[model samples]
Target: MTVDLIAVVPRNSRGRGVQRYYDAQSECAFFVSEPSGQPELWHRYLDGARDVYRRFGVEQALEYDAVADGASTSLFFAALNADGDMVAGTRIQGPYTDARQAHALVEWAGRAGADDLRRMIADRIPYGVIEAKGAWVARDAAHRAELGAAISRTVLHGARLLGARYGLATVASFTVPRHEACGAMPAERIPAVPYPDERYRTVPLWWDTRGYSAFAEESQRFSTQAEQDALGLTAVRPLDARCGAGRAAESRRGHGR
Candidate 1:
């Protein structure tokens, strides 16, 4: 629950060389790894997400099997307390080759803004796009807001590590401002969607990795830059060459979207 955080440090090399960092502000240790390769950690993340989603009465929105398979997840982030319980987490889905590959597009299908959502993702595909999903924090955790903010910053961290220039998220209206503090902007032109039975108005949010620093809060900017520096990334690299080449071919075939 504390906000006076320490520097990011790698605590161990277990779980297929899982990376760990400390957040003094939140009083928690954060872990990053590939989902499929770390079965124990992967299950911990799934369980934590499921518990939080169920508490919010939006458990139906989660696709358990799809998430469990871990085939599409490129990076997973988890936060644990001193006692070693998973407290907060999120996963990055892809530097996708197709717009339809995003769960948001699937959730928007048959809806009014479906096309707009597709186009939004398609336009960013060539620049490297990733969907940050399954984000959650335990309700009983101390310093909930601070912890949540810390988790939000990981979206940018994960995107940069994966060579992604843009990241997308479909978050409930209430959490919009929290994400925005970390540089996510709502797609205001598109109307909100009533998802998981209408109790929630979910809207699409995007982060332009190249310029998020200009919009992020000062503390957030400092924290993000510190984390990136710890990872040895002096600057944001361009989209991975493989992703660029593949997208070019996909665009030529009119399948980029």
Candidate 2:
């Protein structure tokens, strides 16, 4: 049920530029990079995410400007076709110090379930929490479902790599099943919010990195575990120096997660 086709290839001598993950079964290559480490690819990811958001009529919700410089992002994940065109991607933000740091707090502000959403994040912050955002897939990409599954696995891989105990994602109602397959559970106690407009009902989902296998689908369990194992051997680079300093300062201020 699991394919052992994912391999990580370092894209730079210093191990800081980009790390490529090639999935032979899908013939799709996934790249993980920091904005400062590989600006070009980082921009590609931003552009791709923007395009997807625009087409979905949720561009405003994306808050592109806020993440353009990638100061708030810990890592970027891009999935490219064999022809080298990016088809899907997502980004990781945090290991947050406070519940208010989650984008959901802002999105749910003055809306239904805002308080419960805040509580959910606050409870996880002490365990180390990261948010997976800007996730998208090209409309015309082949094997879209398979690619989506791969991207979900990246959430697990990323959370583990970043030392996060939990991961958060706010997704449209329809996408909940896909994420759930990869061990993301909806915060059902908090009513779903009509975000970016009433056209969609968005719900907050959480991934307990330490116990995901208990809920993840069989194939996902094997594949995510395989990918996480592979990532363990890869030398993922640290955040940009300025970003590192900022994190240090936040920690010193007693805001560390």
Candidate 3:
């Protein structure tokens, strides 16, 4: 079938089945909404991001996009079958404002014996954690493998392109939530982070190939065709969203214990 990835705006997301699919999975979850069990997921992701930065000597930092602002995000696209259905999906948490460290990263790659690797990440590091957010295709044994490969490659290329465009880096660490059949896929040259458990092993389409900090204010979503065009790859976007109103009435928002 024809697989296409499109942006699902907030107002229009009402009937997109995103909420319904989430609800179904949330039935036995820790929270009535998304999984808040481990506030550490974000930490782990950032840690992983920074870990990649050390080699590049980039000033690594983390940005948390908690609210859905209709901006760019990681979402999957799977073609519908005979039955007018399109429930397969995937999502990764990042592109966390880190793209300005490529010059050094590219150099680092060259020093490491992979000039192509430097070039691959000179733009973006298709490296970030990914987990299958939703997928109706998992039920079918026949279509599962193809779908998995499609998704993994999709994720990889998205990260690569984004990294290249923004001068950022990323890692595709899939410490995903549950999905047994998905884990069966072979790990390509890219390394994999062990999944949490059966219930949490969400499918990881792929990881970012490269930095930890500095981002381009002009990041975009993972274009479905872009990934395919890259032959497999992975960026960050501007993240200056703010809601400043009557701040005097409140106080401040910064990092502190």
Candidate 4:
């Protein structure tokens, strides 16, 4: 997860404002944003993640329905190459006012006797709670980097930037261990909700950032270097104020919540 902060820019070639990070360990580039101010880029990134989800046969995993209102309080995290092509990406949503955005979990809560999850979030993580969603990595790009760990770090880092204290994710049974290693707990009472036409089941997990020691020990992952040629070299460019304005047409078109 170690990367160097080589440059900080307001926008990339696609005109989307982002915080870029580079990792020399795998010679990979990382990009992240919290509800990107650039609407078009946000949509495009979401689309890319969605495309990958469909490939995995779980299009419903994409939370497009909730964010359709367009007031996306979501963060998009991506991994790319030096060329800047999106090799992998995912979305993180929330700090929700309530559990409404967690559609599936909320629907299944009562039946699973996990209605307390809402109370737990309210009591322990009332603010800055982020939901990890639509995680995907390109098959071809897997060899170059640890997409799961990389993106999980991206989500955690993005959450920290957004002032969130906790993270939640509902993922397939098989994907649970990877997240646990990054510091998350399997949320109790989250029933096996069938998705992608009942062939799949998803479970929910929650993580208290304070409880996770990985991020602390892995601090090197976010470190930057002055030299660009170093091995495991990486870079992080924070989003600039200028990039927040977005495109004039997009602003004019407006968006809903």
Candidate 5:
């Protein structure tokens, strides 16, 4: 049997017996193809994220303010229980614009080679951060662990899929603390958290890391050696194709997938 979440997937195959909102498939599960058009899924994702943005290191007021200013494309999603109860809500933004379809313009701009750290704002390009709102996991410690893993697989897969098609080289996010209550405010003076903390959420985000590279120049910067080590990030040389003329696009394309 297959389970579709938010229609981004048309059918995902798995075994029966609902646990933690996802059907068990002998411990192996997969998402079905996106049933609907991609644009609709993108909008649906953004709407869900907008519903609750404040608690997750994401500043609702700031994000909305950016939207009002001129936001474009964004990513949004929800995790649900077997009863279809919402377990968590979040959105990763792209760009914002008053025009209803301006999000596509933002995508074009990014693929055309715009500055990621600077141009990719909620108002001008796309929202950089992914925010979780009203998030919950099974109360049992064991169940919670599984819940995090599921989220990692799903979210990472979703983001990577999007980034690959768009020619995006990197992804940036704002995570919240792991153990803080779902509604906890971000700890920084900027009034947000970086991402879900390592304790509650997995220490290194187990998703997305496999697909895109950090922007390097402007990623969530770490000052201390400990912070650097914890994120498990390292610098590597550019791809071999980048050195040659005819293969730059192909090289980047291969790296993205």
Candidate 6:
């Protein structure tokens, strides 16, 4: 559900001589950029995500292709604590040419024999789309709700900035509530389905980027100004200059699903 990025007033911080900004929604200081130039940082977060995936006995590791895809054409939205430790993060891939070439969708459909799913996505090709994947939070992070919300909006806003009409994700059942809070709904006719991976049972979902109104709806749910402020965020700003340059360079490198 399209998160309101402008809900929070952001403040800048200077630490370790590294430029950083505070994300009120996530309640953590962070830096958002591409993975290529930040290999160690990227892998550190990936390791955390991998650990989470392992605990569930689901997909425990990322394939080479997945890593290459991310390094070549994805943005990293990471949440960091005061010690500059990345506690949670997520990756987003493309404004793709078609469904067949997009990340995870094609293989997932093939595994599930979801030809109709593929066709539905192909039909919507005229409207640009992106896939959100590899989201994970450190085992010990405070304000988990706010961190999830922060990651959700970061990917949503990132997709919008790249001119995508929608953002897609294959999320685990447990994570559906968080996605719903961010305005993500089922991409399939059935809201949640058994994924081919019996371990995780992740379900496909998507959120509209064009003319979304959930921000207005969500804003009204809060009673006082303080409550509202706590849930607010400067949504799109994190994906500003530095983030753009990375994606722009990756886009120039090549285009893939």
C-alpha lDDT values of all predictions: 0.78, 0.75, 0.28, 0.56, 0.30, 0.57
Error of 6 at 94 (Å): 1.0
Model 6: worst 10 consecutive residues (lDDT sum): 8-17
Q: Identify the leading candidate in terms of TM-score.
A: 1
lDDT of 5 by residue, 146-174 (tens): 44434433333333334421212111233
Return the TM-score for each candidate structure: 0.85, 0.83, 0.30, 0.70, 0.32, 0.69
Query: Pairs clashing in candidate 6?
Result: 1-182, 1-183, 1-184, 5-233, 5-235, 8-233, 101-257, 102-257
Off by over 4 Å in 1: 1-14, 237-257
Q: Residue 251 error for model 6, in Å?
A: 31
- TM-score between model 2 and native: 0.83
Q: Model 6 over residues 77-193: C-alpha lDDT tens digits?
A: 667765566778877778778687665554365355366557656766787878777787776787787777666665555566567767777777788677666656655443344
Which regions of candidate 5 are displaced past 4 Å?
A: 1-75, 95-145, 163-257
lDDT, model 2: 0.75
Over the full model, what C-alpha lDDT does candidate 4 score relative to the true structure?
A: 0.56
lDDT, residue 19, candidate 4: 65
Per-residue C-alpha lDDT of model 4 across residues 1-257, encoded as one tens digit per residue: 44333332225434445566665544666666555454544666667777777887777657677664446656676666555556776777776666655554553655553566565556544656777766777767744335666665555565565567677776777776666555556666546666544777777666654444332234323332211223222333322323343542232222100
lDDT of 1 by residue, 115-226 (tens): 9888889888898988888999999998799898988888888888889888888988899889878877776467888987688888888876765655568888788777
Tens digit of per-residue lDDT, candidate 2, span 69-117:
9999998888877666778899999879989889988878998888878
Top lDDT hit: 1
**For model 3, how does the per-residue alpha-carbon lDDT over 1-257 read when each residue is reduced to its tens digit?**
33222222222232232211111111110000122222222223233333433433332222223322312334333323323233233333344434233322322332332343333333333433222222223343245544444443334343443343221222323422111121112222322222222222212222322211111011112322333333332233322333343331121121000
RMSD of 6: 11.1
Model 6: residue 169 alpha-carbon error in angstroms: 0.5
| TM-score winner, 3 or 6 | 6
Better of 1 and 3 by lDDT: 1
Output the worst ten-in-a-row residue range by lDDT, candidate 3: 24-33
Q: What are the clash counts of all predictions, listed in order? A: 5, 0, 43, 12, 28, 8
